[model samples]
Target: MAAAKGAGTKKPGRARRKNRPSPRERLLASATSLFTTEGIRVIGIDRILREADVAKASLYSLFGSKDALVIAYLEALDQCWRNDWQERVAELADPEEKILAFFSKAIEDEPEKDFRGSHFQNAASEYPRPETDSERGIIAAALTHRQWMHETMTALLTEKNGYPSESLASQLLIFLDGGLAGAKLTHDIAPLLTARDLAKQLLGAPPADYAI
Candidate 1:
């Protein structure tokens, strides 16, 4: 009777296996995970393929080459981050709250276990002076995201919040860059907290009392 009952039950594992991600999806997932945690240059295609359990042909067919894969990874990262930030601030009515929420999300959303600084920043540093087309693509992918963030913040501060100049937005960008570096160096969230407080002061928002 036990054997009969077991035979009648559907296998959850089989259902999950049937719904597994495609080869391209698997390759990107592996590349993003390894590249973010390890690095863009340090991790090779073999390692990504091994981790992804995918074939070389699939990678080439999907991404063309390793450099292309890196570009795709950065592009995906950029999209996910911007989408998440927009979603994070969507419901908030206050423009200042929306601005401050960016910093808050950085602190609250990201896990510290294997935290690395911004993937874009890391990739840009890894290829300091881009020479090849692929290198340029990689750097462009990184800078484009930063540029979008800068423009968005500037518009919010100057146009929406009645800030006199765009300089405040630039300063806030610097603060965020410095804070990310500090947090990456120290493996702590203190720097992010400090950055948020500083941003609040700049925005003339109510002061937060955080000791870091």
Candidate 2:
């Protein structure tokens, strides 16, 4: 009887360990999904803990507070977006094609419901008063991501076709921004397709080459 009881307890313990997410990872994943779907302010620490299935003590131990979790979440999102784009771009041979690929992938991944705007933009709006270091860090990270897209597109335009790199880059960025905003506001993919058509015109290419 004693041996059976010990084995049962050990099994449950092992199962619990397997089921639990690491505190830091749990908080980050929870915050990312919540903040991306809902406004950051609307989702509080309690909700994060519940969604993460982590203890309040564990969250505090890992992140210290809600603000820290939010910063970490944004940082994680930044890394993820960068890595995904790099992977997608790597699949294409031409630099200009890669630029179009980036936009194409963005539209393909449009959310089905509760579609909030860009995570960076939403976070910036929520934490307008950046009195803390954490908020500043998130803002810097978000800006870096945006700047990277522009710089990358500019370099590709200059290197691939010798276009007016600065002007072309600005135009492309505006098109992309407009597409994302329109997609969220209108809940339609037509805007994305329109953006792709405009991009092809800007690049002087056939629709097949730049189809998103």
Winning model by lDDT: 1
lDDT of 1 by residue, 1-212 (tens): 99999999989999887899989899999998898888888998899999999999999999999999999998898899889888998898777787787787778754553558777899999998889998999999899988888888888876555544456678888888877888888878899889988987877842231101
lDDT of 1: 0.83
> Model 2 RMSD to the real structure?
4.7
Go through the candidates in order and give each one's C-alpha lDDT.
0.83, 0.77
How good is model 1 by TM-score?
A: 0.85
Per-residue lDDT, model 2, residue 115, is 43
Residue-by-residue lDDT tens digits, candidate 2, 1-212: 99888766757778888988787777788888788877787888889989888899998888788877877777777788888888887767887788898678768876644345467776776767788787787677667767888898988887776544766777888888777788879888677778877887787753234332
Worst 10 residues of 2 by lDDT: 203-212
On the 0 to 100 scale, the lDDT of residue 184 in model 1 is 84
TM-score of each: 0.85, 0.82
Q: What is the lDDT of residue 203 in candidate 2?
A: 78
